[model samples]
Target chain A: MDNQDEIRKIQLVNQLDQLETISRFLDELAEAWDLSIPFVMKLNLVLEEAFTNIVNYGYQDNETHEIVLVFEKQNERLLVSLIDDAMPYDPTIAPDPDINLSAEERKIGGLGIFFIRKMMDKVSYQRMGSNNVLKMEKVINP
Target chain B: MMNLNFTEVNNYKVVQIEGRIDTITAPDFESGIMNLMSDGVTKMIFDCTKLDYVSSSGLRVFLMAQKNISTNKGMLKVCCLQPSIKEIFDISGFSQIFTIEDSIEYASGS
Candidate 1:
């Protein structure tokens, strides 16, 4: 990675609209770097789900919060690290949606996270002090 | 961003949605379809050939449109789904409820 290409960061308000903006930013970045479409789509979906989850459910009082997203292209993959100041919650601990249930029978919610897990090559969640950090990476090839 | 073009083919109101139909765009989609319904254009086919992606919110709008059309004694058809978008639909079991076709011609034929 070049010194200038090590990392790029953006600060977003915890809101639904941020999902599209972030996805577009990542999409353009991926295309500029010649990343695969599948990889870009997977990363966009994961970020969309994660950020939306935070904006919709993470804050109990609906107060303003900031989410920092960092994009970096590593040796063989792209790494996106999201840091947010919100309540402590681990998405990985959430129960997997029962795929057996029909759409009508299944309860609403949780589907986004499930899709993210299926799409991303790697996902990690951690809470450090006041920041909830989510790091997801995907290999450029296969 | 999605470019939505509304037109008529064989007297059936067809909505062509290009680009990703995800959360941010689904609300606009729901309103657009509902506008068609208000105009007495219920028998519809959503031409999704250019729709490269969709999320659960997009599915919700589809369900809303389906219910509205079904109750109005009309029909809604879906055609030309890209594979990435189709996988989401298939995984969500939407394929069972939606009248999916390989092409607009095939869907309009019925």
Candidate 2:
């Protein structure tokens, strides 16, 4: 394969409103890179879930933090790494919601991370210094 | 972005939701459903034909509606889901949780 890749990053404040910014960025990238809409929407879903978790429960204080999203497209693989300076939390450790349970038995929690695992081909988490990095990757289906 | 329209068909309030229902739009969508419930309106059918995308938050609202309808002795049916959204429902086990119909007529019929 060729050794060419495109990398881009977007910095967002620790606010729920930034969800629209993420969607817009992905929309523009998909249009410019000629990526399929469905493929990008999956990426968008995971990104939204990851971002919501960070912005909602990451920090303990009222201080504003910056969340960063790094995207790289190489060949047939698309990878996104979310970096945040919030408390040390690893999303990959969360248990999946039991899909076998009844509606009343199931809790509303855990589905976001579940989606990240289900939609992505690879999901890995790392604690680097003060930042928690969650990297998700998916192979483009041609 | 989301657009919601409500109509009555065969004793069921059919709510047609269009566009993506992500974190940004979920609260609004939830409130819209809440309004219907507060008005003592139950036995509803959710038409998701144009709902191209749904995130975890959106799924939560769906679950809430279902639970509320059950508690009120009413029924909540979801119909006309796009394949992509259906895959989400399947993965989340929502397909078994709610009554899913291929058409709004079928959803309202029962």
Candidate 3:
């Protein structure tokens, strides 16, 4: 767990259609690792938010961009790292949505990052060599 | 990969959603709900029993539908969410905003 030997990685192009492709990859990972239903669901949720953000707002041009995701299991926790060569954006520091507001008054811009924060136990962001690296971890204990 | 089936039950429009609602399918989902609202169908219940997954985009659609229904003086309820989807709703605090029921009968009645 301390080494990178067990890390699983998937690379994708920055496109909305790639969400399904990445989701299938996660499903395979879940089955291979015997991940619980809730765990897999949460991971998928986080992936969708992070990946969609990169695809929708990360690029200024229409050209395709690369997005890399790495998964690692350490002790009782699962760590996921999403790396993209898009704009330098840190979702960890994004504003939390005001969930206390009524449905009519609620705004939608920040809910994705907010959900990512709420579901994951730990979330860290770093700009590494022109890549926006977002790392998230969740406890996977039964 | 999402399918939305709309049915009328006791004068309430029930939208049964299947498959995953993510960034790609959220626009269609939003427009479908908006179509219902434009058609003057306000009393709605979203049946999420067969919905495998939903991301933040889907939540935004739900919020928009709720707001539209409220402005029209209509009602909106959701029923039969899977455990995982329910957890997302709970985390987003949607459980407090929308009336959620265990069954469509309860949702329609309420």
Candidate 4:
């Protein structure tokens, strides 16, 4: 049998508590795909940043919105995409925090997006119809 | 699952955090820092030996505590971070902004 690329997916609502579910999902993927704990955590941090951004500021209504995460192992590359129906947001273009700034000069709010960009090897965002898709990738063992 | 244990060493209020600090638990972490600041406990040491993971949410709390402590002329130092967590601190430029020590004793100057 040809070794086909493996794919796993989890659906979460735009809520902070779902981060635990996301962590479990990533942990399960690590166990199945033989990913390192540190690598799993890197992905975890990236997803948490993106997920928190959506939950806190993506939507303006009280209604619940669904966010789907698709994880795929494409040979040596690991890829994950976040799909949400919230307002159009592009995390990749957000200005990075001034890392050189002292504590007094730093701002608390922008570091979430900055962590996402710094942790992932490649990050891209696209507004597909009504959904916001943020794609992230990392090549393993390079 | 996460837990924060507080201990006092000299003038430093050492906060030892265990488990991952993610989106769900960040609020608790924030309140813990806030409570300490309000109590006027100046010198602080964040013992992170058991803290394996931290997202930006958690980092924000760290920054907040630092800002609050510094403004009031108090010291905040983080010690015993796991390498992975330390890398997060490093990449986020947290290493530069916080006084990081290799041991809690060093952090508390005890």
Worst 10 residues of 3 chain A by lDDT: A1-10
Candidate 3 residue-wise lDDT at A56:
85
Any residue pairs clashing in model 1, and if so which?
none
Better of 1 and 3 by lDDT: 3
> Which number leads on lDDT?
2
Chain A TM-score of model 2 comes to 0.93
lDDT of 1 by residue, A77-140 (tens): 7788889988887877787766665434555467788776767678889999999998887777
Candidate lDDT values, in order:
0.79, 0.91, 0.88, 0.89
Encode model 3's per-residue lDDT on A41-89: one tens digit a residue.
7888888988888888889999988899999988678899998999999
What's the fnat for candidate 2, on a 0 to 1 scale? 0.75
Q: Which stretches of candidate 1 lie over 4 Å from their true place?
A: A1-4, A98-108, B38-42, B70-74
Q: Across residues B58-89, which tens digit of lDDT does each residue of candidate 1 receive?
A: 77788778777877888789989887777777
Q: Against the true structure, whose DockQ is highest? A: 3
Q: i-RMS, every candidate?
A: 2.6, 0.8, 0.9, 1.0
Candidate 4 displacement at residue B54 in angstroms: 1.0
TM-score of chain B of each: 0.94, 0.98, 0.97, 0.97
DockQ of each: 0.34, 0.82, 0.84, 0.83
Top-down TM-score ranking: 2, 4, 3, 1
Cα error, residue B68 of model 4, in Å, equals: 1.2
List TM-scores for all candidates, in order: 0.84, 0.95, 0.94, 0.95
Task: Rank the models by lDDT, top first.
Answer: 2, 4, 3, 1
